[model samples]
Target: MTKRSRRTHSAGLKAKVALAALKGEKTLAELAQQYDVHPSQITAWKQQLVEHAADLFGGGK
Candidate 1:
C-alpha cells in the first residue's frame, strides 16, 4: 500500500477560503467541499481573520 502525502496550502489560499466563509453566502460544509478542507479548519481561519483584523490597520497584535 502506498502512503498518502500531506497537502500544504498557502496562506493566501487559506485567507481566500476564510474570506469566503466570512461572507456567509455559503455554509461551512459547502465551503469545505469546494475548497477540499475541513470545516473546522475553515472555522479556525475565520476566527483568526477576525481576531487579527486589527493588525491589518497597524493596531498590532
Candidate 2:
C-alpha cells in the first residue's frame, strides 16, 4: 500500500469549511466526506472560528 502524503489546506478553504460546519445544515461526517477532511479537524476549525469570531468585530479588547 502506498502511504498518503500530508496535504495543506488554504486559509480560504478552511474558512469555508468552518462556515459550513457552523451552518448546522449537514452532519460532521458528511462535511468531512465532502471536504475530504477528518471530522475532528472540522470540529476544531469550527471551534476556532467560534472562539475568534469576536476578534473580527474588534471585540477582543
Candidate 3:
C-alpha cells in the first residue's frame, strides 16, 4: 500500500466542515467520508469553531 501524502486544508474548507458538523444533519462518519477527512479532525474543527465562535462578534479580544 502506498502512503498518502499529508494534505493541508484551507480555512474556508475547515470552516465549511466545522459548520456542517455543528448542524447535526449528518453523522461524523458520513461527514468524514464525504469530506475525505478523519472524524477526529472534524471533531477538532468543530471544537475550535465552538470555542472561537465569539471571535466573529469581536469578542476575541
Q: In model 3, which residue pairs have backbone atoms overlapping below 3 Å? A: none
Model 3: per-residue Cα lDDT over 1-61, one tens digit each: 9999999999999999999999999999999999999999999999999999989998778
**Ordering by TM-score:** 3, 2, 1
lDDT string for model 2 (1-61, tens) is 9998999999899999999999999999999999999999999999999999999899777
In Å, residue 8's CA in model 2 sits off its true spot by 0.8
**Model 3 Cα shift for residue 38 (angstroms):** 0.3
* Most accurate candidate by lDDT: 3
Can you tell me which runs of candidate 1 are displaced by over 4 Å? Answer: 1-4, 59-61
TM-score of each: 0.85, 0.90, 0.93
Q: How many clashes in each candidate?
A: 0, 0, 0
4: Cα error in model 2, Å: 1.3
Model 2 residue 20 distance off true place after TM-score fit, in angstroms: 0.6
